[model samples]
Target: MTQPRVAKDWYESAGVRSGPRRMLEEDREFGLEVFPERLVPHLAHEGLADLGAEGRRALLTQHFYQYMLFTSHLETKVVNRGAALVAHGEVDIEVGPEARLDAFKIYSDEAYHALFSLDVVQQVEKVTATPVLPYDFGPRMARLDRTVERFLPDHGALGHLLQVVAFETVVTRFLAQIPRDEKVFRVVREVVGDHVRDEVHHHAYFSRFFKELWAGLPPRTRSEVACSMPHFVNDCLRPDLGPVRAALLSVGVPADRAEEVIRDCYREEMLVAGVRDAGRHTLALCETVGAFDFPEAREQLQLLGLAD
Candidate 1:
């Protein structure tokens, strides 16, 4: 019997060598514009202060493990999808030069976000009685598993692009709303501001990419995508409610009301609003890219609770 071939590491794969190098070069140039050298340490310190010693440790631990998993998945997506683009000679060397530049800038920003998160996790772990890694929470673990299975398929270029749009949109909004503090909020503001600039372009790229994919699909496939969009939004917006519930329960909130309490928090509101914003922006992007009509797409987005 033939043995199944193991998937190779995306970064190390032959397909990723050139594209990543090109991507990296573009990033280096973009870095000159938004390095955040003056902002990161302050933000890191502020984020640390927001979490008490225990909370800081827990947050950092969660960020460390989650980022590792997320980066692994992203590397695979970039490598495989990039390889396919190369094979098809679909690489947009002309237009791609600009897109690659923007993507590289965003990638650099993400590295800082990941490192800051890891720092918090490590510090929290050292001081907390019971530090909680991301996977320690049931809902988060379940979502992570589901996300990997559903969106991280063998060939998911469109899905990968959507993932970027979804995440960046939320991060942008979340950063915008965090209460300003000289130490903490300042760093977040600077980092998020840089991210927002790059993400605007990233969102544009995904919007264009999705429209092309949607246009090429059969009518029936387009219908299927439209129908499935709500579920996708739900999955994307659902929070790690387990920890929130536990925190509430620990404080003597009734078990039945714990979930409700968590849902009522500002964080949940921000999540819903962010998802709605992404949905609207995505549709607008589709229109700009010449993929679909706004009226029709608006109806679909409304069904997903993204439109009023």
Candidate 2:
């Protein structure tokens, strides 16, 4: 027997012209140029203010090396999965044409994000002496592996949808908060812009999927998952500021000062705004799916310092 043909549409399955594509074009046209002239001095000044001069330089070096590795690893995984999905077009098998188009747009965005991350890695290596280590999120990856084993197998399609929705929501939240003034921030923002654009579609696609899943779940199971969501969100929001901090401390900044700097960076109003937007988006998703009340999610938001 032959496999069934999947439906394609001009806007959905035809190509990658969408929000992400527009953002990429905007970046190419208007994006700030990052280089040693602006970047090195910015790092030096910021580091000096936060950690003493030495600590500042050290943290910059650490960040240069560590972020390259970390983002590279993350982008690689995202690209592989996104490429596979796009190539196979299997995810849209059950969904409507609109959803498939949205998913395709997301896949294209992921590809761009992955390529942008790789480009940043190369750029950092060219300008800095920091050595790239053969390491990344060792403990976290192990934990995710175990969690996937425990949760992914039993949740069926619904479980998978929930996980994807939650993760994409959180990632979009983070990408939207990145600072834009610093050279590093600019580079990071460009890469993340792609992710943010793509994630909007992913969130939409999963919202529909979550609704279907939620309607079918037994009340007891629904309650169990709802209760667990706060902890899950907390774990996801735990910022890995270690690399940033280590970089500062390496340059001779006192540990206390480094901590203060990290806190200040995260405490910016823009970061808070991003958190609020993300929380609202997640709450909206919850409303759509009829999973749990906003009050329950608000508690989680408070735990993450995203709400009062």
Candidate 3:
């Protein structure tokens, strides 16, 4: 049995009481230039390509926009929605008052996270003056929704809940790295770090909740969710070269150089490093939830190099 976490402390630890409250001003310790290195393939970092400071900066800033956008999307759509279902018993999963209370707290946290992520984006825009990827705002979640519907037409919420559980269970590791990564800007570090603190607690919450949800679910529904979960995880972690390519072009990176960057950056080895590792937590959690117990799902995850 998975240990149940005290949900109330998570509410307190969301940093609403105290943490980076003011807008991030441009500062010397954390300049825009140094924010997280190696936006492209390791070749660029290894001096195989001359992307220049501006090119690298543009790449990182574009990546920052993606980071914030996804964060907001997750907090609002996935986490918040999951909590709402649990709190209101809209889904089949039954909830006690204590669990519902905790879910409400998470509901608040998710909303705040969504709001704060956009604020960080604005602060980043002030410093970098780069285009945040608003165009990407809809496609990712939409893709997941479409895929889930195709898989479980009658029970879309089951897939959504599974995906949310998968992502939240594993997202802590991804969020935790940002705060400690000295290469990123200080404010950005603080922003992600603060989020990480909450996610640590969230990881616990989702892990326990998913176990309960899975136990309550019917066998056929569980089987269906197991099959569909990997695709949702893929949707979350796979890096699209489209935005990267556009950002490079916007910054006057020659087309040939941009192609080279994309080619080298998205190589099979790099995909394992960036995409697989980014979603490792999700994969593991999915396995625990029996998502990978199905033969087809296991095969799919293995094909994507996500099978452990």
Candidate 4:
């Protein structure tokens, strides 16, 4: 049997020796001419050079802040709701005060993540003088949340548990990458790196919590949640290409070329591959817990090419 990872003593386990990190003036670069080429798949599109480095920087700058905006809003939902479930206890199981305290630590981390992600957005805004445009989570997450709410109208603890566990377990894909790429602004690297350090702990905490929560479910409820898990996982994994499309269009990318670029950038196989890689940890947990043992979940997984 695998030894379960512990979430307690987050300060030590999370390796956050230096305490919290934030974007500082030293981390800021004023009017950097080089835009992050890897910000999207449209890297080095035919129009970028014509956009010029400054123009390219502006577009990518807007893209950067808005991306943070959308995600930060949603993390509040996942973290707070998960915290409530932990604190209040669930249908068949109580997470207990000790566990709830740990959950609160995650809540603390996630809330700080939301706040700092906003601060990073503001930092970009101040430096670039470009405000975060009106952007929601886009169609994918909106639809997924609506559907999940309908499926589990009560936001049942089980439903919330599965959703939070699955997402937090997998978000390392995004959190881990943004900082490592030195192509963008120094502020981005610094802030996102700080965020990632905390998420390393959150991912570990949630992965451990997920297994325990899943094990706690009653058998019949487990089967029901199992059937719903794939759809939720797919929703969690699906990328919102719409934002990228709109970004290209706003940049005066030619209409046909914009559509073409979006398609080329997000090929079906490539998208699937990306999610399979990104969500590997969560998918594996779901599988070990027999999420795919049910026919409906298996079918969904198969349709996503995640299973046979």
Candidate 5:
């Protein structure tokens, strides 16, 4: 592996280094939508779209709650753990002290993200009076587990690290749109805005880390792992339709209609485009590291329609 280098001016420029981010200030005027309708695709379904303003508002609020739910889980369960492993040298890579220190920063940032996500969840629950419906990480984790078993059965910590790399590097539209969208509530905008700022540095750190890690892997192992990249990219970008369906049902849409709405709104083409667009940076990073140097690796990604 190439010698790992510390990110440039991380302590001075990182959002976490400035001091703990201020907690989101609740807006007294809570009537503004907590999430933009454009961010939630299923809301565009004809039946769900016709639910009128108040109904749409409730669904948007619930979608925001689910967004926090995803953030909290991703920060605590996925990113933090991966960052902790790197910081402590528990992972397979041999990173420099500077790299480990940056991983510690990532770890700290993600934990703070989880706390604020839950805090917003509480504030929104009180303000909107929309009870958070049942949500679970089981199915998501299970799908990931199944994918790993199929593609990299003995991956162990490598699997975890790869998942972290995928999520950190893949910028999703939902995260990008929330802060600048004036239609979203002020508090929600502030919360996501804080997150987006931190992620900018985190993205750079992980991109460099992935290149270093790929340089360190054996050629055969590299080929095997590269085959799984498209799957991981899809996992990172695909919308969690389970929660969307539940939110729809809770908001009084019939179960049948909810399923139809999700299916219609998230067609195969739309999903492929979302995954490709969101994962473009990750794919380019892999290409930089020669992850697709082997014909088989390129073929695997092409089969997923992620590359030409």
Candidate 6:
């Protein structure tokens, strides 16, 4: 069994090294705005963009809330679940002590991340006086749940492991991109910047984990998991427009017009482009194990606009 290249000196280098983050009261007043306008691309729609300063701020705040909520849930529910499975030896994959120890560290980082993410969400709510709009576990996780349901009664754990593998191995662009825009609120950028630093090590750990997991699977099981890769990529990267539509309506756009705005901004081509750009790392990792070699998997990828 190939041992995953565990992150070195995690006690010194990990985000958890500093302990949990808190949103200082002054952070709310530090930036002119609460969230970056660029982070919410739907605002670029002429109809939506014209929503003036106040309207735009309302929308950006809601978008920011949804982002933090999404991050919190993903860390606690999905990533941590995967890490726990490996750390506790619940998974079938055989790994070295180094990998298991790193899994524990990953688990800690994810929990700390979730804590800080929720901290910001609550602080933003108090600062903006805008309660987070009601949402499910987030569209991406909801989609993953539905996909995992198909393998119920037997392969559920395998399905879940693959989903985590697909998600963790990717070099997530948003993690870095969110902090790059200095115009974004200082707190938002700082929190995400911390996450970005941790995920760099996570990306390396999971890449090696995937190689080990793939090497040990039987051919039939490999094909079964491979068949789901395209859909997994699609589920993971496709932008969820529900929150955008809600944010638009909250900003006083009429119901019908909000739908139109979402349709225009989140067009089919734009969705495909997002997946192509964000899913590249995951798709490439899958290809490393020939996940696309199966005709069924290849067809699925092509149909999802991930391939010709």
Between prediction 3 and prediction 6, the one with superior lDDT is: 6
Ranking by TM-score: 6, 5, 3, 4, 2, 1
Candidate 2 versus the native: TM-score? Answer: 0.59
Estimate the overall C-alpha local distance difference test score of candidate 4: 0.66
Give lDDT tens digits, candidate 1, residues 1-308: 01111112323332222221111122223313211223121124332244354443333334333433443334334323442442343532222443444344445434544444444334334433444434333454355335434533433444434444444333334444332323332333343344344345444444454555565666554554443344445555554455444444443445755455444453545666656664555444444543344355456556555655
Candidate 1 vs. true structure, TM-score: 0.50
Ranking by lDDT: 5, 6, 3, 4, 2, 1
Each model's Cα RMSD: 11.4, 7.3, 3.1, 3.6, 2.3, 2.1
Q: Whole-model lDDT, candidate 3?
A: 0.70
lDDT of 2 by residue, 1-308 (tens): 01112222324532234333322222442433332223222363453554454444444555555644665554445333543453444432345454545555555555655556666655555544444444556654444344434434454333334445455555443335554434433554555555554555555555555565466567665654553443344333344556666665666667887687677665556455544554555545564555455456456545555543
Off by over 4 Å in 4: 1-21, 24-36, 47-49, 138-141, 149-155, 171-175
Which candidate, 2 or 5, would have the higher TM-score against the true structure? Answer: 5
| lDDT of candidate 4 over 1-308, digit per residue (tens) | 03323355666644233445556463445544223556456656664457665556667766676667766866787656866677566434556566666666767667777887787777657766755566767575566666567556654556766677767777545546767666556777776777777777667767777677678767666666766666666677766776676776676777887788777777899878877777777788888877777787677678777773
Compare candidates 1 and 6 on TM-score and give the better one: 6
Candidate of highest TM-score? 6
Q: Model 1, stretches more than 4 Å misplaced? A: 1-112, 123-133, 136-157, 168-174, 177-201, 211-220, 229-231, 250-257, 263-274, 287-300
Cα displacement (angstroms), candidate 1, residue 47, comes to 26
Which candidate leads the pack in lDDT? 5
Worst 10 residues of 6 by lDDT: 1-10
Global fold similarity of model 3 (TM-score): 0.85
Model 5, range 196-219, lDDT digits (tens) per residue? 888887888788888778878888
Flag the better candidate by TM-score, 4 or 5.
5
* Candidate 5 lDDT for residue 135: 69
